[model samples]
Target: MLELLSFGDQGWGDEMLLAGLMTILVSLSSVCLGLLIGVILASFKLSKSRILKLIAEVYTTVVRGVPELLVIYLLFFGGSSAVMYFAKMFGYDGYIELNAFTIGTFAVGAISGAYSTEVIRGAILAVPKGQFEVGETLGMSKFQMNLRIIFPQVARLALPGIGNVWQITLKDTSLISVTALVEIMRQAKVAAASEHEPFVFYTTAIVLYLLITTGSNKFFNRAEKKFSKGFVIEEST
Candidate 1:
C-alpha cells in the first residue's frame, strides 16, 4: 500500500500532490472573495438606512439557512445557464463557460461570506462607540476613519472567527468533487476507485488534510500573536 503512494510512474504521488495544491489554491481564493463580500455585507448592516440593513440581514439569513451542498449544486448547474442568458442579452451568441474551479470558489465564497458577515459585524460593533466619536471630533473623513482606526481593530478582533471560517472554507472545497474540479478529495476518490483500496487512499487523504489544517492553524496563531503584541496585559493581583 505504501509503495502505491511512492513517487513513480506506477504511483499516484504526483497526482495527489497536485490535487492538494489545487485544494489550497481554491480555498485561498474562496476565502479572499468571501472576505470581500463579508466586508460589503458588514457595511450594509452597519449603515443607518433600514432598507440596506434589511437587505443585508435577508442575504445572510437566507444563505446561512440553506445547506452548502445545495449551494454548490445551484452554482454548478445554474451559474453557466445564467451567464449564457446574460450574454444573449448583450448580443453575444457564445456560451460564457465557467469551469468547476470558478463555480467552486464562488459557491464556497458565498457561504463563507454569510458567516463572515456576522463575525465582522460583531467585531466592528465591539469597538467602543467612543472610538468613532473621537474620529469624528478629529474631523477625519469616513474612509479615513475606517482605514486608520476602525479596520485595524476589527481585523484583530475578527481574526479568530475568520480563522475558523477559513478552516471551514478549506474543508468545504472537498464538496466541489461533485463538480469534478479534481481537488484532493476527488483525486483520492479516483485513486480509491482505480486501485480498489478505499481505506488506504482515503486514509492518506485524511492525513494530508490534517497536515494542511495543522499548518494553517500555525500561521493563524502567528498572525494573532503578532497583532496582539503590546496589548497583552500583565494582570497584577
Candidate 2:
C-alpha cells in the first residue's frame, strides 16, 4: 500500500497532491464567483423594480430546481457554443472554446450562487427597519446608509449561510470530473483504476476533502465570532 503511495516515479503521491491542489483552487474560485453573483441577485431581488425581482426569482428557481449533474452537463457541452454564437454577432466567427476548469467553475458557481442569493436576501431583510429610520433621521443618503449601516449587519448575518454554501461548493467539485478537470476525485479514480485498488485511493480522496472542509469550518467559526463581537449585546436581567 505504501509502495503505491510513495512520492516518486514508483508511486502516485505527486499526482494526488497536485489533484488536491486543483480541488482547492476550483472550490475557492467557484465560491468567490458565487458570492459575487449572489450579491447581484440578492440586490435584484431587493430592488423596487418588479422586473428585476422576477429575473432574480427565475434564476434562483431554475438553477436550484434542476439537478446539479444536469446543470454541469449543459454548461460543459453548450457553454462554448453559446459564447461563439455571441461572438459571431460582432463579426468574430472564430470558435470560442472554454476549458474544462472554466466550465466547471462556472457550473458550480451558478449552483452555489442560487443558494447564496436566498441567504443574502434573507439577511438583508432581517435587519431592523429602525436602523434605516435612524439613518434617515440623521440625514444620511440611501447609499450612505446602506454602506455604513446595513452592509456590516448583513455580512455578519450572512456569514454562517455562506459557510454552508462553501462546503456544498467544495463537494460539488467532485462532479466536475466529468468535465475532465483532474481534481481530487478524478485523480483518485485514475489511481484506483490503474492500481486496481479502489479502496485506497478513494480513502485518500476522502481524507483530502475532510482536511479542507475542517479547516474551512474553523476559519468561518473564528470569522463569525470576530464579526459578532460588539454587535451582539447581552440582554439585561
Candidate 3:
C-alpha cells in the first residue's frame, strides 16, 4: 500500500500531486477572473440604464440556472467553434480546440461569477445611500468615489460571500473531469482505472481536496479579520 503511494516512477503519488496542483491552479485562476466578472456584473446591475440591468439579470439568471457540467461542455465545444470562426476571417482555416484548462476555467468562472454578482451587488447595496450622497456633495469623481469610499466597504462586506463562491468554484472544478483537464477528479479516475485500486486513489484525492479547502478557509478567515481591522461589529448579548 505504502509503496503504491510512493513518489517517483514507482508510485502513483506524483501524478496525484501534480493533478492536485493543477486543480489549485485552475481554481485560483477561475476565481480571480470570476471576481472581475462579478464586479462588472454588479456594476451593470447597479447601473440606472434598464438595458444594463436587464443584461446583468439575464446573465446571472442563465448562468445560475444552467448545470455546471453543461456549461463546461458548451464552452468547450462553443469555444473551439468560436475560435475557429474568428481564425477563418484572418484567412486561416484549421480545426481548433480550446485547451481543457481554458474551457474549465471559463465555465467554472462564469458560474462562480453569476453567484458572485448577487453577492457583490448586495454588498454594494448594503452600503448606505448616504455614502453616495456624501461623495456627490464632496464633488468626488465617480472613479474617486468608488476607489476611495465604496470599494473598501463593499469588499469588507463581500468577503464572506466571496469566500463561499471560492469554495463553490473549487468544488465545481471537479465537474471539469469531462473536459479531461487532468485535475484531481480526472487523476483519481485514471489512477483508479490503472491501479485497480479505486478506494485508495479516491481516498487520497479526498484528502487532497480537504487539505486544499482547509487551507483556503484559514486564509480567507485571516483575510476577513485583517480587512475588518479598525472596524467594530456589535454582537447581541
Give the winner by lDDT: 2
lDDT (Cα, tens digit) per residue for candidate 1, span 50-156: 99999999999999999999999999999999989988999999868899999999999999999899999999998999999989999999999999999999999
Q: How many residue pairs clash in each candidate?
A: 0, 0, 0
- TM-score for candidate 3, please give it: 0.94
RMSD of 2: 2.5
lDDT score for residue 221 of model 2: 87
State in Å the error of residue 91, model 3.
4.5
lDDT of 2 by residue, 1-237 (tens): 988888989999889989999999999999888989999999999999999999999999999999999999999999999989989998998978999999999999999999999999999999999999999999999999999999989999899899999999999999999998999999999999999999999999998999999999999989988998877633559
Could you tell me the lDDT of residue 185 within candidate 2? 95
Instruction: Rank the candidate models, highest TM-score first.
Output: 1, 3, 2
Candidate 3 minimal-lDDT segment of 10 residues? 228-237
After aligning candidate 3 to the native by TM-score, how far in Å is the CA of 162 from where it should be?
Answer: 0.5
lDDT sort, best first: 2, 1, 3
What lDDT does candidate 2 reach at residue 87? 92
lDDT of 3 by residue, 56-92 (tens): 9999999998888888888887988988899999988
Each model's TM-score? 0.95, 0.93, 0.94
**Model 1, TM vs. native:** 0.95
* Runs of candidate 2 exceeding 4 Å displacement: 233-237
User: Candidate 2 or 3, higher lDDT?
Assistant: 2
